[model samples]
Target: MPRPSEARPSGARPSAQVRRFTPAERWVHRATAALMGVCLVTAGCLYLPPLAELVGRRRLVVTVHEWAGLALPVPVLLGLASRAFRADLRVLNRFGPHDGVWLRSALRRRGPRPAGKFNAGQKLWAAWLTGAVLVMLGTGLLMWFTRLAPLLWRTGATFVHDWLALALGVVLAGHIGKALGDPEARRGMRTGFVGRWWADSAHPLWRPGD
Candidate 1:
């Protein structure tokens, strides 16, 4: 076999990059994020007295928040038209032996653990956020159309919605922090491609098929 230096011409760059996301997947993610941001901002303005006073548009804020929350699931539903997205959903859903190992290693602060395209933490976050968004939507609808439900139901929905919105905000901040710290991950989500070296080091078990 040829030596490392002889494997390619001098100054040649590595070309083993891979596509990390599809165009449809990227679009869906962006759309969902946009809608979620709108919902969060509006919710804050509606709930916080100082923010509400500064914004000074109660009716408009409420309208925007309701509409944004209701439409948050649209992009994911539309993304189901793409085979790639559906395949990724399956990957995110299944927890294999490596997932357990990865989580254990993570908690123990051990050295890097083998992982696939999505790690155990990412999979859990995705599953949780999906459920949370759906619940928020349902509760929001109940609160919006108050006449559709009785007083007790509306009261419970309001309680859940308020607490869940706070939780979502905190979780979202952590997600953004992680994304900001990982340039390769940000690049992959933004441009749909990631360096082969990054994949090899961070997600050793990841394969193109996965």
Candidate 2:
């Protein structure tokens, strides 16, 4: 018979659960999402003729879009007060040796691709969104304050901004699709805790201590 110390009680809960995200992280995510939705909706009103007609206020729509774009970084900046957010930013900024392996494994749909707290895909998405936001903000400011730049430069900025917005929209759709498909990932962002089994299977390198 197994020793009392080694034996597990029937129906006992596992203690391997880990904190996936902090409260600050979830707040930042939700705030950013809300602002992004505002930007996208206002953008649609400004860009689409039918929507613009329905809204019947082009100037107001443009103002909302510009301000929403400007405010995109606010939540993230505020969330930086949390040490976990700063640490996650560092992790997202640097690609680890295992990242390439994880990507390859994901593409092949075989093997257990161990990752840290944030996987390669998540890191890539974060980097892309950050760069896209900066691009949009800069171009948007130029467009907003027309006299700040020459006519040619402003025109070029408009072109770049419009095309980049389309690309970002596509990327956002993919991001949302992946999130919707993964309930555990959504739960992690929602409640900040994730099951140990999920952590081990999806991110084996992640530890409670880490």
Candidate 3:
């Protein structure tokens, strides 16, 4: 009988199964958002002729433009498909009267933050972003599948799409700039676990126990 052929193992090792991203899922999250960012920036550029050169090639930009729109919203949808995302969203989403107090204090130039898992500003940002995402996705589908809409609906969709694009462009710039300003803040989302102290300090109310 021929000697058993020396071969690689049939089963993957336990170490091989362990993953940070269950198949690059974190990277996928980053990639989809990055593509969406490109689409938004390019479209915003086309809003003014002076910015067009940076975007370049109208037809090519348009091609990239639509594809990116189609690509984003997918990951979020997939995230929503998960029970954990829903649970986490619920926790991240709850708003409280203390949040208002926090907001008022900040507005009054008081550096003191009302302790919680999230401050008023963070809650407002989260709430506003959720609405923006819904509006963007809904209007995007209208523009993406134009044939489904009558002339009036299509026209309305176009206007809303353009306006939202402009508005969200500016808002997201602030969002990204803030992220870049803080190293720990940026890492929290990537790791999905903020340092316990970071969490406590940043969101006093949301501290693990209280």
The parts of candidate 1 lying over 4 Å away from their true place are 1-14
Instruction: Write model 3 residue lDDT over 1-210, tens digit each, in one string.
Output: 211111113342323211112223454457666976887767866677877877678877777777787767677667766654555567658867777778888799665566465567766776776687677767777877878888898889889888878787788788787677655455555764444445444555663432
lDDT tens digits, residues 82-185, model 1?
A: 99999999999999999999999889977557789899999999999999998998898899998989999999999999999999999999999888767778
Score candidate 2 by TM-score against the native.
0.90
Relative to the unseen true structure, what is the C-alpha lDDT of residue 80 in candidate 1, on a scale of 0 to 100? 99
Q: Which stretches of candidate 2 lie over 4 Å from their true place?
A: 1-16
Per-model TM-score versus the true fold = 0.92, 0.90, 0.72
User: Per-model C-alpha lDDT, please?
Assistant: 0.88, 0.84, 0.64
Ranking by lDDT, best first?
A: 1, 2, 3
Q: Give per-residue CA lDDT, model 2, range 1-210, as digits (tens).
A: 632223334544466567989899899999999999899888888888899889987888878888889999999999999999898889889888899998898799776576888888888889989999998999988999999999999999999999999898888999998777777678788989876767766777877666
**Where does candidate 3 clash, by residue pair?**
115-205, 116-203, 116-204, 116-205, 116-206, 117-205, 117-206
Clashes of 1: 0
Model 3: lowest-lDDT 10 consecutive positions:
1-10
